[model samples]
Target: MAATAAGLTGSLLLPAAQAAKPARPLVIAHRGASALRPEHTLAAYAKAIADGADFIEPDLVSTKDGVPVARHEAFLSETTDVAKRPEFASRHVRKTIDGVTHDGWFVEDFTLAELKTLRTIERIPQSRPGSARYDGMFQVPTLEEVIDFLAAQSATVGRTIGLIPELKHSTYFARLGLPLEERVIATLAAHEYTRRAPVEIQSFEVANLRMLREKLGKRANLRLVQLVGVGPVKPSDVAATGGSLTYADMATPAGLRAIAEYADVFAPPTRALIPLKKDGRLDTPTALAADARAAGLRLVTWTFRPENRFLAADFRDGAGDDARNEAGSIAEMRRYLALGLDGFFTDDPALGVKALAG
Candidate 1:
């Protein structure tokens, strides 16, 4: 049977009173305070909490020893100095992840102790050279460590901070005998973050989320977010029915309703929610926000960075050398906030906090 928002009951739907939009949308520090420090490190997360971010996002991948760690992808070359370590140079290998071939040092190939030896480097050094200065300064952190740090931060700040951990490449990991859902759930349960904590598990795949929902059962009050990418959906995403479903399919009313059955939130790229028009300005807001809300789902968006190349042409300031415009990014964020988005993921949490306040 097709799912409908009206059919949802229990914890799925928020009361009408609680559904009202807030004065300020949530500022989620994407990969900690990634714009200032190496992503997924303790320093980045600490800086994010200090900058007034309501939530800190960690993309979780597992080490060979079955420990959940914070990394943007299972592949290590892009964000870590794994390639330079001569001792582990033999670990470089090619593998297919979620139907795409990746050649690098994957996280699953190393034990926790071995993985910790490598230091994080800024993924986009050209755009964020300041972040590159901290390369080789911090070790990759475990999921348990991140939870403990946030718990301590929450106590010190006297306010509850949230954790949004994305389970990266679930199916691929599962195929490799390292399913992330169980590991993540076990970690959260061990840390006492399973219930009544501001924690959300996000993923691009659908089946794993359903599996997680089953694992959590009736006590799953923590938010579940379905992350939509730009391209068509993968075979793993629709493995049940032997049918094809794109991310665009998930944005429709019916798809939103279906997602609402298991997920509490829908997080898509900014372009998916608001595409650029021919003139390079943002076009009319898509019905995604409204449809998602109507389907008893909250809306959040991702990866807001401050660069002229990323900003809309209208939002951009003077061209050429003056490309990295913070003002343009803030203005763009403000426009999205005005659309009543529940939250947004940004590399610069402080800037997001300031923009939302303004």
Candidate 2:
């Protein structure tokens, strides 16, 4: 018990000069202060960096021309003005991605030039009315644009900001002849800043992370993170290949040990670390944190949002589900931090900063 508690912090032996500064958990901005700004925009990334995020996340999807763009998913209907654009009305089509069939305009169906003509919008407008007001105000950004923007933001902020880009639906993209791994790597290598700065490539799929580990080798500033899903869910890649490995299997000590062979970090949804009870209050802490460390993996989770809907029951108040309860949100995070996370993702990085401050 003591060992698990101690190891959960991921405290490392540092040189005497560095030992004076305690290692704090990383504050990762989930889609760039997405609680406020239209996600995956320069405005959102800027807000996150300004609010003191150690890393900003960009979920990568490829366009028809094979260019990687920052978006939450391959589908464009929820997060863009594509549905309202007259020229793109004919582009609507149904396609099965990772087993789910959706009828809508997909990023993979549009070229980068065509995609740039569309603007970003809030995915959940009812919960974030303020963000919805900025609908059609920001352009969908390419990975190159995001990298360049991060480089510029780093210079202007006088701090070393980092990038954590997740290769969304890797298997799906690979099937479309628009495989993202090499293109993303090429883009990263092209940028001088990305070459030197901290770049963590994340994915829910296993093959891509393994491939990245083999192709990139080990780098001082680069890490490969494996994002775990809930329950017996199999990763898209594993599912596509008809493999039987479930995320539940991956959460096991043996599974994590296997993951440690290729990936630097093991990240799952927050509940996987500490599950909630039937009543919505937090249940007993799961052994996931301890198990990951036992397997030689760094621990992290996604995400922490400021709204009551996303808060743990212990933190939510009389305020409705959509209400943004800053105090409750911070409290929820602090409770989880007590379990000794190496890092965490949050929709509002300012609150993450505040939660870390104490």
Candidate 3:
């Protein structure tokens, strides 16, 4: 009987040990398997978790009621069926956001109840018709809902699923008397995800990230990431804050070091890692990755898709097909992985998982 009990204990231990095996170069689902579902919906996030993503990324914007919701931008026209809703016709108006003029239904103009009347549609139907089929089928999800969904999924799957919520247009929202930092922090804290939770708050604006660090203080230990945009920083971005630093400045070694002070991760566009040549083919890698590493920051790149348009010319298999070329995407991911990237924000997390495995 003792011998039988020992064998049973070893068998149980084997499954636990196998489950603990580490996954390298984490796969973050950009907008939650967005290539397969309407972005920012519960369906999208659930699909991403099912596909084995390490984290589900939600870009957060606030409704007029000040409820934080998952949306790529404050503008709702692009991803929602708001245009078809005749009741909201007068709600459509032009407004300047972060120095750019946008004409549409702004999230900040509608209360959460009004906003819930709309359903999500595929943001990029031209590239992903398969995803578009589910359009008008999924409702927009709030950040709180997303956190709850992830928590429920974690319990069901017997594994911890992470969340990386990007605070969209912090400065713009602050100007509208709806600063995102406080709302995000309050939501996270309310959920008891303040300490040691698999959550990271990210932002494109620098001042807000600094503000967030101060707001969280030493009481809550949440990770922060600074997303770097392409090209020279806009003059408006500088003028808005009366700061001299541009995105170009932020990509420099000095800028990375500054980021390391407040942020745990530096996520730049893929081009920042490997620049494109004159012919649009991928050229040699830049020093950003190495510089980021030197500053004690983990490097993650964004928006890895399988389409020819998004892929480097060398990776594209002619221009006719919109469907993802799995082989080509995997090859490109492999090239990026060779640079020792810490993680990737991919539309297809399953592909990322397979590429990282090889």
Best by lDDT: 2
2 or 3, greater by TM-score: 2
Q: Which ten residues in a row have the lowest lDDT in candidate 3?
A: 12-21
For TM-score, the strongest prediction is 2
What tens digits encode model 3's per-residue C-alpha lDDT throughout 1-358? 1122223222211121111212588899999999899888899899989989988999999999888999999999999999999999999999887677889889998899998989999988989999999988988888889888888887887777878899888878887898787777667655633223466778888877786555443222346789988767743345586877788888889989999887778999999899899998999999999999999888899979977778888788885558668788888999899999988999989889899888
| lDDT by residue (tens digit), candidate 1, 38-76 | 999999999999999999998999899888899988889
Give the alpha carbon lDDT tens digit for every residue of 1-358 in model 2.
Answer: 1122122112111111211111789999999989999999989999999999999999999999999999999999999999999998999999888777989999998999999999999999989999999999999999889989999999999998989999999998888899988777777776778766777889999999998776556666777899999988899999999999999999998999999999989999999988999889898899999988888788899999988999889999968999989999999899889888889999999999899888
- Lowest-lDDT window of 10 residues in candidate 1? 1-10
Indicate whether candidate 1 or candidate 2 has the larger lDDT: 2
By the lDDT metric, which is better: model 2 or model 3? 2
The reply for model 1, stretches above 4 Å from the true place, is 1-23, 218-221, 239-242, 319-323
Residue 92 in candidate 1, Cα distance off native in Å: 1.5
Full-model lDDT for every candidate: 0.81, 0.87, 0.81
Instruction: Give the TM-scores of the predictions, in the order they appear.
Output: 0.90, 0.93, 0.90
Instruction: Give each model's clash number.
Output: 0, 0, 0
